[model samples]
Target chain A: AEGEESMAAPADKRPISTIVIIIAMQAEALPLVSKFRLSELPDSVFPKGVPWVRYYGIYKDMNINIIWPGKDTVLGVDSVGTISASLAKGACIGDVFLASDVAFHDRRIPIPVFDLYGVGLRQAFSAPNLSKELNLKVGKLSTGDSLDMCPQDEASLTANDATLKDMEGAAVAYVADLLNVPTIFVKAVTDIVDGEKPTAEEFLQNLAAVTAALDQAVTQVVDFIAGKCLSDL
Target chain B: AEGEESMAAPADKRPISTIVIIIAMQAEALPLVSKFRLSELPDSVFPKGVPWVRYYGIYKDMNINIIWPGKDTVLGVDSVGTISASLAKGACIGDVFLASDVAFHDRRIPIPVFDLYGVGLRQAFSAPNLSKELNLKVGKLSTGDSLDMCPQDEASLTANDATLKDMEGAAVAYVADLLNVPTIFVKAVTDIVDGEKPTAEEFLQNLAAVTAALDQAVTQVVDFIAGKCLSDL
Candidate 1:
């Protein structure tokens, strides 16, 4: 379904010209795309053998990673270790985390999210880019941990004016943001953060198309990024 | 050279016991036997891999696991993920990393490590004989995050004391310990925490005997645990 939507996008409407490397994992990928109401993405979007894959077509152009560091520190850092190696070998880095997922053990831990983005941006800027300096942005991203999106509390949402939610985007943003990279988390409110009635499947169907559209827009921006000259990049 | 040190062991030291299982990866296997320090152990105990080696030797009596996690997280967990899946299967969890390998940038953060012995002890008391509980000790562990150790830096050492000066122990302990299992760490300390002038290769040679002895001791302990029962005859 998402594939059809993306395919139908007019060249002007298609944001392929600026495709940012959407490095995402697990739950983060699902909510982002599901909110766009994108039913499915191109098969080419994901390589075979990913750790988690609950969502569809929105990740079509992003480099979706499967490792989640938050729950399993070792695997999480293992992903980072590989990234570090990539950095050593001269990998270009993004400028922000654009994190949207935030859940605490208590779900009440003060959100140092802004601080997390601040640090990530600092480190990402140093990523092996042709240009030593890149403009970075950190924005509020909405996300939940599970595909069902049934656990989010409404009071939390009402407190923070977030637009969408997923599990993985926040971690992605946290890591990248600390690297001092610019990040923008385009979010969609698929489910009430806290609600008496939560329907994950229904929420997914409701927001899928909008997410695909957002992904399309984000991809164009990233494409613009990839085409920039390193010195002036 | 380390293997050769086993030569000095009394001829009878080599166990008549052996057990082997097919594995898909080497990292998981390395944890069971290779993890010990030779200096602390006696002779004859060792992990034997196959192709040309004697298989049905005295080790037929050995309760060994030639394990393979079977192709990277094929089941709910990758060997590199963390303790969750290992815990779920109720398998012998080895190498629950205390410190992470510098494969990613997120490796630098300090985290708490809880020992399993305490919990193991609790298990033993509850299941008395079915499975004994082990202690869970929480302490700091460190790996060679740097090329050399700063032994002179009292503060750092104090801060990271229980920290495994090497990497693999804590991971093993983390997983095993969490489930109230007894675990041992035999690290080949190529780099001391102290600022040493010794080259890495040179240091390993000096500690070769120690490593060998430690390795031997650990093997015996493993045998003891596996054969906790009295002689049948």
Candidate 2:
């Protein structure tokens, strides 16, 4: 929170009314759904044939909505039209990281102005008090569709000064920023990007345990956020 | 239009009331802004410090909004939270192409099920009558941030069976598909991805001419779409 002053403020700083948790993988979603005792709507709120699932319940005076994009679909930009975290760099598995900012590491638009644009660097809504209370690691999160990083991706990651990498964080940040919604990312590391094990193998081996940790951390974060205004956080 | 039967129907087939044209570059946007006689908004509709520009007007009973992301920003997923054309394969300069489908040429999520999601293959809304009336070529459009293609990108593009390459088309198509907004892409070729000339040089050389062609084609398409239902297209 050293540079909290530079972080963009939410368009609206009113007291928290709703908290939406967006999960791409079903494994990461189910545990939280059960913990919150959310009800799966009998009918999908999405367009017909899209496999996205929604679960909602009231938690501590806030309407909590959890969305799972299902197995077949990746998180599309539109999911935000309706509606992060758990990965890191140089971190041990199960270590929780909160996004101070987010960006894209895979895109490389080399044109003069576009090179900056292609990186899609965005600031996550500041949550300094919550970070201090939870003792969280706060740093930049980089996103791309790919699971493993290549040399070019590595260069971009370094350029982005990324502390965590994931598939969906920046996208969520982008939309949240656009809508002026205050956003915070709580991520539990499952596998280190530059670690010894192959990403896929290590991810599968650690996913369940890490997801539980993420669920716990997110619940704590939510509990702290329930009635407080974003500015207070 | 050969495989039109498989195209997904719009969630709503009502008459078009508003048309949104999202242009990433100012050069590509200005002509259409003039053609439509759109007035630039005096106040920023977006969050402060973001350079996104908006122009609006009414043409032939349809409300038209043109958005330019400005020079410094790439089209973020959020831009769609607010809204295709002109690059092709085997296409001569100034040749207009309509997107039959769109996909990403750069993302490589290697995991099962996720890989399919990574490719993000999405079909553009079918426009058989519009294509027939305009005499425009229709083919799969591929999007990536890079101005130039690498070997891996080429492989992905081939896997996508892409006939056009662009920076922003697939993102736009993805959002439109998710919203069931009935999207169609009309592009004028500035440079061919596989051509002998270096992409940057060719793109810079041809941009003005191609954009003018794009403006004319888009004007005609708008005229054709004015006061018509999505189903009519």
Best by DockQ: 2
- Colliding pairs, model 2: A86-A187, B80-B83, B85-B187, B86-B187, B86-B188
Error in Å for residue B207 of model 1 = 4.6
Evaluate model 2 with DockQ and give the value: 0.29
For all predicted structures, in order, the TM-scores are 0.34, 0.77
Q: How would you encode candidate 1's per-residue C-alpha lDDT over A119-179 as one tens digit per residue?
A: 1221122223322233323233433222322122233433444333344454555444333
Give candidate 2 misplaced runs (Cα > 4 Å): A1-18, A39-56, A67-89, A126-129, A226-233, B1-20, B37-88, B126-129, B195-201, B224-233
Model 2 gets an lDDT of 0.74
- The TM-scores, chain A only, for the candidates as listed are 0.38, 0.87
Docking model 2 quality class: acceptable
B45 Cα displacement, candidate 2 (Å): 10
State the lDDT at A19 in candidate 1. Answer: 25
